[model samples]
Target: MKKVINNPENVVNEMVEGFIAAFGNDYKKVHHTNGVVIKNKPNRVAVVTGGGSGHEPLFIGMVGEGLADGAAIGNVFAAPTPNTVLEVTKELDSGQGVLYVYGNYSGDVLNFDMAAELAELEDITTKTVLVNDDVASATKEHAFDRRGIAGDIFAIKIAGAAANDNLTLEEVARITQKAANHTRSIGVALSPSSIPSTGKYTFEIADDEIELGMGIHGEPGVKRTKLQTADELTANMLDYIFDDIELQENDEVCVLVNGLGSTTLMELFIVNRKVVEILNEKGISIYDTDVNSYCTTLEMAGVSITLMKLDDELKNYYDKPAYSPYYFKKGRG
Candidate 1:
């Protein structure tokens, strides 16, 4: 396996050290832990989310003034330990309480639950909103039980804004759940990524093949077929998502077309253009649009599209100002 690194075992630690060196002054690392909290003492409801590494600008990238107050880092594709999450919660807790938002993977659910239990011993009230926005994970009949994917960005942004607006913990949790319910995501992978330590691809895909509905961690998707043009790929994904969500004309939505690591910005934009065209033809109004490599699967080459059905309340919170390493917007601008 060809990669740029010192040692496979030390990649996570080294990368994290470099991350701190680049942005540590803007944030503070929790002592003896793989976590970071906002430099400013949190005066409002604290927000925290995390999972395995490899998906940069995810849990950590969202740590800033208007996003998560703290993030617990885990190993590549592995959930953070309960102790690590507990420490982060303790460090970020203000008198107001905290909200935990994370994907619906089993490991995360288990570890965060343990961390929440630990925090309860200290009388630090905590609540969690599981993100299950991957439409490919399940049908509408099982939407609430599906796995989470790129839609997490919207959930974090909305919840963070609520917290920044001085909403109580319960309110933030409610807002986050609402965002999750309104959001849907579907992804296609052209290539697989290698786990640093394993020195092997997490999954295998033929050179001219693509996997639809694949999970971020190389989980099996709905189907595999020969690679199609960008327009065809986008249509296939959007059709599945629209059918699942039952989006209608005159619906206002926020669109996110995200790269899964190795895809080029130009390619993502090409896909986004087609996505916008199709949505417009259907009379769906886009309230806002973001296209970037916000979430990734190591060096996998693919992209996911997320559409969040928006109402006035969701739009208000989404438009609120946010500044994180990965996302930035002026307040009410």
Candidate 2:
């Protein structure tokens, strides 16, 4: 319940206002909406992604050159209303078309679809690619039903690159779907996060325990057990992710060690250390790696590992440079 804010109900609005003020040079708040579109008008295919707030550097922090062209900001841990999505879609649509990429959550799917339908009334063509990368959410038999998490970063980057390269809307959508399907992730939580409004923990765990395979929004993990060492935890998570994807020796991949919220950089690097070691042992080449709190739940003590299996096409797009508030990368190595 300890949060630095004037009022719980005003957190989303206040935070967004501050964001626009700070990043005004790069983005502008859409009129009458809690969304921001990149200041640089998109001449190519426009890209948009959004979801609930609280996960900083996500839906919002990602709008800029080479990333999301527009983002609909929503309430803490809640989906953006269909109206919000519609407004963002309108702002992002260039003469070419618009592509919507977001997690495969029910609320997002429902609202984004509605927004797309509304955009058609204006003759603005729109398409969507849902990111469902949390391997722990479902078995391979039901992979499409899996929830999205940190792997969103990869999906966004890949799609943005394709769009930046001037790929057609249909081509961008196809490649974006390919990136979404090739990505996989798993997370472990050491402590639950507290919602600012209620000042209540989403869930609880013991002092010496951890929850494996948990979702960013505190969804139940596969199991809760005494905490294991960094190596053990990394192995458990990687094993599950690898089993879900066919990553062979000599294959190349991108690694993302994403902190849920409060986990330290020190801890994330420790996890990354083990991730790289294991990948090397398995003969997978690391193209490049990122470790940071890109997507997060407020004050949640956990981290998620995301691996995007790469082909030449995926690698080319992934290497394309991008600039946003939180995520910035100069093209590939």
Candidate 3:
């Protein structure tokens, strides 16, 4: 219920404005659009990914040097309009094809598909890779039915690197899908995030409790229990993720500890400490690691851990240099 703003309805607009104001040197707003961000420098295969607005540094903060070339921002926790996606797609097309990558949500899927169809009519080829790495969202038998969450960063990074490598549109999309398939993520929410307009949390949780496997939008979790220690929570999260993707000894993986919104770096590192401890115990090699709030849910107090089991191809792309407003990695250390 507490927010700093002029009008609730104008939050998205002002957010876009503020983003452009600060990052105009690297990003430009699409003319006559609600929420479309285009990179100043074009890529061989334009990478586009977006979703609702509340998840900062996601659909927008990701548009830069080594990430998505463009992003179509949607309303808070809502899908961007088809027209918005179409416009960004069109602007991104520089003879090379465009790749649309976003989370797996009903509204997002529908709108992005529509935009792709519209772009095809103009001879602007487009491909899509829907991210569904939230292992807790579905059983292995229905993995594709799961919702996308922090795993999106892996998708975008691999796709953008492929595109930057001058790979063909189909190649970029293929590798991006491959990276997505190797990824798994799960989260725990200590508190709920509210919609600015409504000034209400989407769901309620007790002050001394947490929801395990909760989705970013306050979706029902596997269980709601009293708050546990950081190590306990991390172990529970890793267990859920490992149930879906087995990490064999000597298998190399990328570990990402993502803060939702209000979760601090100190907390994320604590989670990462446990993640590393568990991985080392299993003999899983850590190739690269990142701990930050690459994606967030509007001040939600939570963290999500993502693991991308890497093959040679995926590791190459994962180690590629990337520079975004919110994400920066100089290859792998």
Candidate 4:
């Protein structure tokens, strides 16, 4: 195993420290905890989302004025401890209450559930909405029960906008779940990623091969085949997404063409162009589009396409203002 690090156990702690050091003014670390909360606590609903590391700009980068109120950091590919989540809840909670939004991963489910229980004992109101938007991960018979992926960004963004509008915790959670249900995602990986601690590729594929339906953690994909051109790849990804969701003409949709990690913006743009062309051919209008690296797999080379079938309400929230380290939007109103 080849990696650059002092110790495997300290990787998470070190990464968290660096993150706080760089963004500490905008955020403050919870004393003796692996959590971060916004420096200025808004009196409206509080949003906290988190999970394992390696997927930076996710639970952490979303912490800002118009996004997550706090984030609980966990080890690479592992969930944060329940106590860590509780600390984050304590820091972000104003009198209004808190909403925990995160991916539908087993470790996250167990730990966040325990944290909610602990927070309730302190009289802190808490609710959770899991993101399960990877249509390629599982079929319709198991959509609600499948794993969450890059589509989580849409959930967090819409929910944060709801909270920014002073929606109740229940309302925020409801809207977040709605976004998750309405959204779907699919990804293809040209390469694998290495966990900092392990110093080995999480999964492997031949040089000319690609993995479809690949998870962020480098889990084995649904299928492996020779690589294709940008247009062909986009079609391969969208075919499953559009077929499964059955979007209709005139449907206003939000599209996210996300780079996993090492993939460049130039490549993403080429892929985005094809995606837009295909969607336009179907007469489906795009309400909003985000083509960037919103989610990642720690230096992995690949991209994921996410589609959110939006309604007027969702489009309104999505158009609202947002500012974060990795994302920014001017208020449309």
Each candidate's number of clashing pairs is 0, 0, 0, 0
Superior candidate under lDDT, 2 versus 4: 2
lDDT of 2 by residue, 250-328 (tens): 9999999999999999999999999999999999999989999998988899999999999999988888899886999
Model 2 deviation from native, Cα RMSD in Å: 1.0
lDDT of 3 by residue, 292-319 (tens): 9987999999999999999999988888
TM-score of each: 0.98, 0.98, 0.98, 0.97
Q: How accurate is candidate 4 locally (lDDT)?
A: 0.88
Model 4 ranges with Cα > 4 A deviation: 1-5
Give the Cα error of residue 149 in candidate 1, in Å.
0.9
